[model samples]
Target: MKALHIITGLGVGGAEQQLRLLLAHLPVDCDVVTLTNPGAVADGLIDDGVRVVHLGMTGNRDLAALPRLVKLIRAGGYDLVHTHLYRACVYGRIAARLAGVKAVVATEHSLGDSQMEGRRLSTGVRALYLASERLGRATVAVSPTVADRLQRWGVPGPRIEIVPNGIDVARFRFDPLLRERTRRRLGLPEGAYVVGGVGRLTAGKRFDVLIRALAELPREYWLLLVGGGAEESVLRRAAHDAGVTDRVLFTGERPGGGLPGADLPSLTAAMDVLCSPCAEEAFGLAVVEAMAAGLPVLYVSCPAVEDLPPSAARGARRVQGGADSFVRALLRVRAEGAGPRSVPDAAHHYCITRSAAQLMDVYTAAVSCTSLGVSSS
Candidate 1:
C-alpha cells in the first residue's frame, strides 16, 4: 500500500530516527513530510532514497500548511497517512481526513502522564489531542504505559494500539576493540568506571539528576551525557555545583549521519553502565540500545524496559525515588562491579524487523476494517 508519513520536524531525536528505521523495513511505498526545520535526519532520509518534503511551517499557528499538506496527500494518492510526533499527529490527521484518506494512524512516541510534546499537562491540551485523535483510524502507542496514558487522557482503549519501540539490535552489540578506541577518542582514562546517559539534555530527561548522582559516586566513576538540547548549560552548571564538572563529558548531539562521527552504538559500547533517570519516559530507546550492547542499565523507571520479560531485562536495574534513589542504585552497582552482561535475546524482542511487521499488520487491518465499514475506534 502507498503511505505518507508526517512528522513535526526531521530533527535527530528518537522519534525522527525511529521514523527513518521504520520506513526502511515497511513493506510499502512511502514518502515523508517534515512540517519545519528539516534537520540532519532529513539528510539521512534523503540518503536512504526516501522522498522528504519540508512544509516550512512558521510555528504552531501556521494553519495555511493544512491545505498544502492535504493537496500533497491527495496528489500522492497515498492509501494510508501515518504521522509521528504531536504537531504532525494533530495536523496530519486533519489533513488526511480532508484529503479523503481511508487509513490514518498516529504513533504516540513521547507522551507521558505529566507532559505531551514537551509541554506542560493541561485539560485543554488533552482536549485538543483527543479531538485530533478521534479523526484517525488508530493511535499507536510505543509502550503499554503510553497506551494507558492515552486512555487516561480520554482516548478510547480500542483506539490505542501498543507497538513498542524497536532498535537495530545487532548494530549496537559490544565491541571491545571499538569500545577502547572510542574511550581513547573521548579522552576517557583507562580503568575509570564510566556511567553513561543518552537522550536530549532536556529538563524532562532529568539529566541534572544524573549529574547529582554522579557527584555522589566515587571520583573514578565518570559521567557521559549524550544528545543535546537547551539544558546543556544548566546541566554543565549543575555538574560544576556538584564539583563533578571535570568528570562529566558532554558529546552534544550525534545524529549518526553515515559519516565518521561518534554513533550511538559506539558511544554505548564505551560505557561501563547506562543510567536513565527520566521518570516519565514513554519508551526507553537508549536503555534498549545499551542492553543490545551487553551493558548493565540502571533506570529510574522506564515502562519500555519494565514491560519486557525478565530474561530480556536480565541486567537492568529498575530503581525508584529520585536522584537519591539513583545514587544509591549506582553505588550498589559500582560496589558489585557490574560488568557487561549478555542479553542477545533482548535484540529478538526489540528488533526493528518485528516492529515493522507489527506495524504492517496495523496498517492492513485498519484499511480492511475501513473497507468493511467497521469502526476502528
Candidate 2:
C-alpha cells in the first residue's frame, strides 16, 4: 500500500521516533510519505529511503500549503494517508478527501492534556479533533488513556483504536560500554548515577518538576535533559533555582535523523533510572524505553506506567513528585532494595517491529473496512 504519514514537526520525541521506526521497517511493498517542518526527524526518514514532503511553512496556519498538499497526494495516488498530531490530522484529512484518497488514518501519540492551560486553543482543537475523527477511516491512540481521552472529548468509540507507542529494542538496547563511551564523549562522570528524561522542552514535559525533585536527591546524582523548545530557558533557570545546576545536563535539539534515532538508548543505558515527572503523558514512551532497557521507571502517578507494577510487583515506582511526596519517592527509589528488584523486560512491550505489525493490523483492518464499505466498527 502507498502510505502517507503526516506529522506536525519532524523533531526528536516519542511520536516522531515512532514514525521513523514505522517508516523504516514496514514492508518494502509499501510506500511512505512524511509531511512536517524540515527537521532532523524528516531527515531521518529520508535517510531510510522513505519519501518525505517538506511544506516549510513560515507559520503554523499556512493555508497556502494546502493546495500543494492536495496536489501531492493526488499525484502520488496514495491508498492511505496516516496523519499524526493535531495539525496534520485536521489538514491531512481534508486534503486526502480532496485528493480522493480512500483511507485516512490518524494516530494519537499525545492528546492535549494541557487543555485547561491551552484553553484558548483547545476549544478549536476539540472541534477539529472531533471532525477529523469522523473523516478518518480509523483513529488510533498509542494507549488506552489516549483513546479514552478522545472518546470523552467527542470522538465516537467506534473510531478509536489503542496502539501503544513502540520502540526498536534491538536498536535501543542497553550497552554499558557504549554508555560509558557516550558519557566520556559528553564529558559526564562515568560512575555517577544519571537520571535521564528525553522529550520536547515544553510545558507538558514538566522538566522543572524533575529538576525540583533532583534538589531533594543526593548531590552525586546527575540529571540529563534532552531536546529543545520554548521551555528551555525556563527549565535552565528552574535547574539553577533548585540548586542542582552543576548536576543538570541539557543536550539541546539533537534529533535522531532516521530510523532508530540514536540519542536516548545510549543515554538510557548509562542511567541508573529513567525519570518522567511530567504532569500528564499520552502514552509515556520514555517510560517504556526505560522499561525495555530493563531499567526501573519512576513517574508522577502516570496510569500507563504506574499500573504496570501490581500492588506488589516489579513495576514503576510512583511518586507525587515536585513536592514533599516527590522527595520521599526519590529517597525510596534511591534506597537499597527499594526500587525494581531486577531490571524490567522493557524491550518485549515496545519493540517497533512488533508495534509495526500491530499497526499493520490496524491499517489492514481499516483498509479492509473501507474496501468493504464498512466502518472500523
Candidate 3:
C-alpha cells in the first residue's frame, strides 16, 4: 500500500533513525515528510532512494504548513498516513483528515511517564495529544511501558498497538578487527575498559551521571559518549568539573558514515561495556543495540529488557542510585573483565523484519477497518 510518514524533524535521533531502518524493511511504497530540520536521517533516506519532503515549518504555530501538508497528502493519494513524534502527530492527524485519509497511524516513540520527547507535559499538551490521537486508526507504542502510558493518557486500550523499536541485528554484530580499528580511530589506548553511552546529550538522559561516574573510575576506564544535543556543552563542562575531561570522548552525532568507526555499530564494537544512566526510557533502544554488539549493558531504566524475562538479556543489568551507583556497577564490571561478545535473545527479538511485519498487519487492519466504515475508536 502507498503510505506517507510524517515526522517533526529528520535529525539523528532514535525516532528518525528508526524510521530510516523501518522503511528499508517494510513491504510497502512509502514517502516521508519532515516538518523541519531535514538533517542526517533525511539524507540517509534519500540515499536509500526514499522520497523525502521538507515542509519548512518555522515553529509550532506555523499554520501555513497545515494546508501544504493537506495538499501534499491529497495530491499523493496515499492509502495510509503514519505520523511519528509529538508535533507531527498533532498536525499530521488533522491534515490527514482534511486530506480525506482516514487510515492514519502514529507511533509513540519517546513517551515517558512525566515527559515526552524531552519536554515536560502540560495540561494543554495532554489535551491536544488526546484530541489528535482520536483521529488515528491506531497509535503504536514502542514498548509495553509506553503503551501503559498511552492508556493512562486516555487512549483506548484496543487502539494502542505495542510495536517495539527494532534494530538490524547483523549490522550490530561485534567484530574484533572493527573494535581495534575503531579504538585506534578514536585514540583510545590499548586495553582501555571503555564505558560507552549512546543517546542524545540531554539532561533528561542524565549523561552527566556517566561523566561523574567516570571521575570515580581509574584513568584507563574511558568514557565514550555517542550522539549530540543541546546539552553537549553542559556535559562537557560536567566532565571538566568532574576532572575526567581528558578521558571523556564525545562523538558528535555520527549518522552511519562510510568509515569503519564512523557508524554506530563500529562504535559499539570499540566499547567494552555500555551504560545508560537515564532513569526513564520508553524502549531503551541503545541498550538493545549494544547487546546486539555483545556488549553488557548497565541501565537505570529499560522497559524493553525489563518487560521481558531476565533470561532474555542476561548481559543487561539494571542499576539505581545515580553516579555512585553507576560507579559501583562499573567497578564490578571491570572486575569481571570483558567477556566474549554474544548477541542476546533480546536483540534477536526486536529484529527490524519482525517489527515491519507487525506494522504491516497494523496497516492492513487499518485499511480493512476504514473500508468497512468503522471508527478507529
Report the C-alpha lDDT of model 1 over 1-377, residue by residue, as the tens digit: 89999999987788988898888888899999999989988888888899999998999889999999999999999989999998899999999999999699999999988887689888887788889998889999999989988888889998888887888776786788988999999999878889999988889888898888888887888999989889999999999999999999999988851222338888988898999988889989888888888888888768877787777677888888777888888788778875655765765688888999999989998888778887645
Each model's lDDT comes to 0.86, 0.71, 0.92
Instruction: Name the TM-score of candidate 2.
Output: 0.90
Q: Candidate 3: deviation at residue 10, Å?
A: 0.3
For model 2, name the residue pairs that clash. 44-257, 44-258, 167-350, 167-352, 291-346, 292-346, 292-347
Q: Report how far off residue 104 is in candidate 3 (Å).
A: 0.2
Task: For candidate 2, give the lDDT of residue 18.
Answer: 79
Q: How does each model score on TM-score?
A: 0.96, 0.90, 0.98
**In model 3, which regions exceed 4 Å deviation?**
257-262
Q: Give the per-residue Cα lDDT of candidate 1 at 285.
A: 86
User: Per-residue lDDT of 250-274 in model 3, one digit per residue for the tens?
Assistant: 9999874221223898899999999
Give the winner by lDDT: 1 or 2.
1
Candidate with more favorable, higher lDDT: 1 or 3 = 3
True-structure lDDT of candidate 1: 0.86
| Top candidate (lDDT) | 3
Off by over 4 Å in 1: 256-262, 338-340, 375-377
